[model samples]
Target: MHEERPEVGVGPWEGELPSEGHYDPELLSNGDRRNVADKYRYWSMEAIVADLDERRHDFHIAIENWQHDMNIGTVVRTANAFLAKEVHIIGRRRWNKRGAMVTDRYQHVRHHPTVEDFVVWAKGEGLAIIGIDIFPDSEKLETYELPRNCVLVFGQEGPGLSEEVHQNAEATLSIEQFGSTRSINAASAAGIAMHAWIRRHVFDQSV
Candidate 1:
């Protein structure tokens, strides 16, 4: 049987009581509690991360950061939710952090000056790089054999994958499109790719 574990911090809160109260006014009255699982209720970010670190996923996530895209934060947040092994930023060292909602502190993120550097690092780690883009001659994502240990690389919002990224990827995949638009939002696409991986490897056994 699985042993019941304590929620939040390693130990219960211990300190002199404040004149105001136990809970912060801003967090309590404003209803600023997190949307995480019940186990993390009223927990600090540090506690949540410690729990997540004990059971992270195997796959890694990487995005082309040449444009300093605001979408990077959303991607990081989603990656954190899925507990991805790591997040790699290719190109620019800095990106818009507003979308990440302060979750970056809990996730492992790496910066690469260029796509070449990312590819080199991934190869060194025995991680196969898979590019998600709707380009000609690309394999259909639904049918591709995603590796258990791999990095899913996404391009910028508008232009899609860079030439260097395309050339470096072990395989390129395209999501089927039915709408008039050429592609979907970068963050949405990343979520879809991540879910597909989860379904293929993580969920198959249950079904």
Candidate 2:
């Protein structure tokens, strides 16, 4: 008979484990196999979220969820990886969470009944709404300097942004695709846009 290999996560704790408040006794005893990073192993879900909250970036991610878009899950996961300030869902509160792989549990998410409501919230937070879609007046993302405090808004998967949302945006930007396809997947586009912001506000600045 073949022996089962060890779990992908850390082994059960030995002597002198971490502090009481930070670690989860169940996880520590069973060996932490959550999707979180190694430093967060054995850490309580609340502790991990609190730690992430302390370092989250100024930028937020909002998705137009009129159709319960599957891409919203991927966007949430990516947002968590990039440590976005929050993830906003517009038009619908329910979305497919399969792609998020439980990362949504650690993310701060809010729902808006409509684009108008989302715009109002953004305005209240003093965040500039930058839509990610290509149009006649849209600027290439490569040339645009993403604001330090802004919400990168993505629209529906196929139709892209609604006319009203497009019109209300302070500015719209698009990725330059070299392929014959007119557009890429919505989640991929969101990831690219977030990376662009990170490139300018985080990576490049640090260098």
Clashes of 2: 0
lDDT by residue (135-162, candidate 2, tens digit) is: 9999999999889999999998998988
Best by lDDT: 2
- TM-score of each model, paired residue for residue: 0.81, 0.95
Q: In candidate 2, how many Å is residue 34 off?
A: 0.5
lDDT tens string, model 1, 138-202?
99999887888999999989888898989988899999988898889999999999988888888
The Cα error of candidate 1 at residue 153, in Å, is 0.4
Residue pairs with backbone overlap in model 2: none
The lDDT, on a scale of 0 to 1, for candidate 1 is 0.83
